[model samples]
Target: MTGAPPDVSIHHLRAITNESTVELPDRVVEILAAVGPDTDVLVSDVSARSFAAATRRSYSKQEPNLVPFINSLQALGDELVLICQVEHGDELVTAVVRATDRSLVAATAIDRSVGIVHITVQELCARLRASNAPGVELALEVASQCLADDRVRIFEQGALSTARTVLTKYTMAAEKGFDVRGLDGFAGALVPLGDEQPGFCIVQADTSVGITAFTPGNADVVAAMGIGGLSLHSETTEETG
Candidate 1:
């Protein structure tokens, strides 16, 4: 799929939940009615027990901005579901994201639902770091495959958080054609060189794992930073004596 454009615009719709039953709000129903037959939409419930559904059209080889949709829904309540669809590259892509204890659960444009797919931060990072594929494409693949299989588990609480830091650094480095401070907060800050070429440098790849911080600017950067991988703290941290 082609990358997202700079200055991307996203359409948002929200529905309120009823206290008696789990029915959608009028606004949500209205938005769904407005969606065209050709357009796909994503529906998600981000309550404590999160759930999500994506329309079939979302799988097409195009990009859609669902960040606003997710963030808006997140603000409304700890528990709510919203559906949204956007057109990019003339193709319809529907998606949903749910916040869970360890990480945010999201849906893919493909038939696979993002909520059901279980990809940990470590596996995603290792795979992206190893592959030559664009960040977005690879993220879809990794998330999809993980969902299809039951035996694989690579993430913990800190994975996605860590991935974001790496992604920010990678994008900043590429954006300036040089390093940026705080990009690698965990690692010591790389010395910032304004004009002169530094002798030592951290390697920056052309593509990045797709994640929110790197989005909204350009599809290339989105593709480059597709869903940045997670950084998982060891499962077995010791308690202080």
Candidate 2:
């Protein structure tokens, strides 16, 4: 990661929804600490499910490869997210890597503009301890990717399917603001706790709402699940409107 770049930025803990957008890599970790360490930082992952079924101009480059492009990062053991779209941005600039936990090198930012990023493990150890070169192979490659993260088992299995439906009712939420993400099959925005309220969730009296997460595997069950609650219905009532 080259190190030394974290000083409260991710635009300060990202939380942007409504048509969605999130790009906060601490200014790409301060431009990868002003570039060095022999370059080699390649990882392009414009995810959140490749915008509802791959089509960021179809990964551009003359358009062709529709799906089937995850070559490295070592077998990808789940926790798969990776971003870099920013040519315009509906949103998706993830993929944060400079190697604190190394294992980077997956291509396709349309063609090979990889800066590698699929952060978590606390934004990859706060961008590798604000990377300026968190050496020792970037702290043993971020401690073997925080012991092989697996996106915290895919965000605790989407937070136990939103904690077993948390008392049902198209129960929308966001008081503590959780986060979620679905890539490839598309899904990102309201990742934390915002949408998913086909019904309840108003609490305006000065508001309180807590809980900081709910995953449902980041939803993408075939698309159609904007976050919070309503994994293609099991009861958010059959009408929702």
**Winning candidate number (TM-score):** 1
For model 1, how does the per-residue alpha-carbon lDDT over 113-188 read when each residue is reduced to its tens digit?
A: 2322233444444444554433334344344433233333211111222233354445664475532222333211
After TM-score superposition, the amount by which residue 36's alpha carbon in candidate 2 deviates from its true location, in angstroms, is 24
Worst 10 residues of 2 by lDDT: 197-206
lDDT, each prediction: 0.28, 0.26
Model 1 ranges with Cα > 4 A deviation: 1-115, 134-223, 226-241
Tens-place lDDT per residue, model 2, 111-201, is 2222222333443334334434212122223233343443321111121112223412123432334222221112222222221211111
**Residue 178 in model 2: lDDT:** 26
* TM-score of each model, in listed order: 0.21, 0.20
Error of 2 at 51 (Å): 18
